[model samples]
Target: MGKRIRVGMADLNICSAPDSIITLGLGSCVGIILYDRVSKKCGMLHAMLPDSTKIRNNGLRAKFVDTGLEDLLAMLEKEGVRRSSLVAKVAGGATMFNFSSSSEISGIGDRNVDAARECLKKYNISIIAEDTGKDYGRTVEFYPETGKFEIRAVGRDVTFI
Candidate 1:
């Protein structure tokens, strides 16, 4: 069994093959995972918001999709992962509530997913799979060696993306 690195909310981490990465309590947040098959390098980011500019304080930098993915790509490149070999998968981004008068906060989950997609596309990175949207929270575990993304949620079946 490889070491499992835990990535907290609004946090990011990278690992190599034979190892894995995980994150938990992803409600409105989005977990973006990237893998470079050739190098067996993987990265995961738990982003809470879509755009950092929309917020007054950009907490952990990894809390926003736009900023976090840019930083993650750089980290992977630094680890000798080629840009062309990077592929992505995403999970989380649940509505989690029902509001009559919707505000930006109410739409956070969708926005996070949009940001994850847009930002990944901006970098020409293809997203291979996703498990998102609903009224529940999720925990995600990803193994780079096998490129397996496992998603677990309360009262729901384990899903692989």
Candidate 2:
């Protein structure tokens, strides 16, 4: 058994072997996990929002989907993980907030999913699996060695994402 590492909100982590990264409390936020099975290298990003365009001076660029995905990919590449061999899995993007307004006014979870998918497409990374879109929170765990990820929704069964 390797050491378990906790990745907090608005955090990004890149690991190479013997380490497992976990993230908890994902509501409208999304968790992106990229892993290279051959090298046992993995990277995880917890994005709070879909875009960073509205946030001008947050300084923490990895807190948004667009920028966070970019940074995660870059870090994986720098760690010697090739883009072609990387497999992506994601979890989160739950509509935790209940708003009676239209989708445009309160679809943060949907927007986050869209942004993550677009970012992955832009990077040419294929998403192997995903567990998203609901009205509950989730906790995700990524095992680099086996390239396995588990998602536990607040009121649902534990599933592999």
Candidate 3:
């Protein structure tokens, strides 16, 4: 197995073959993984918010899906991964609660998932797989060399996409 490169909340990382990317404890956030199979280039983002425009200069540029995807894509391109050859996988958009709140503000997980989808769409990159939206947290592991993404959650079995 290759080394697992851990990505913290609101951060992003890009790596190459023989290495993998991971993000843990995705409760109300989204774990976005982008990979280029031909070049074995990989990028992972742990976005804490849906939009960056609504927030301040919190920290890393990957704090929101909008900016995160934009920056990640740019980094991948610089690493020689063609945009047309890139594919995306996603996880960690869990509700984390069974509350009955109907307000849109209550469903950050769904918003995160939607934001991830919307942002990825801008680059014309297709989302090949996803394991999102549930009342549980998730840990994501992405191996670019094999173009495989693994999602592990408490109790439930690990899922590979």
Clashes of 2: 0
Any runs in candidate 3 off by more than 4 Å, and if so which? 57-59
Ranking by lDDT: 1, 3, 2
Per-residue CA lDDT of candidate 2, range 106-126, in tens? 688888888999988888889
Evaluate all candidate structures by whole-model CA lDDT and list the values in order: 0.91, 0.86, 0.87
Q: How much RMSD separates candidate 2 from the native structure?
A: 1.5
Please report how far candidate 3 places residue 23 from its true position, in Å.
0.9
Error of 1 at 90 (Å): 0.6
lDDT of 1 by residue, 119-157 (tens): 999999999999988889999999988899999999989
Best by lDDT: 1
lDDT tens per residue, model 3, 79-106: 8889999889989888877778766655
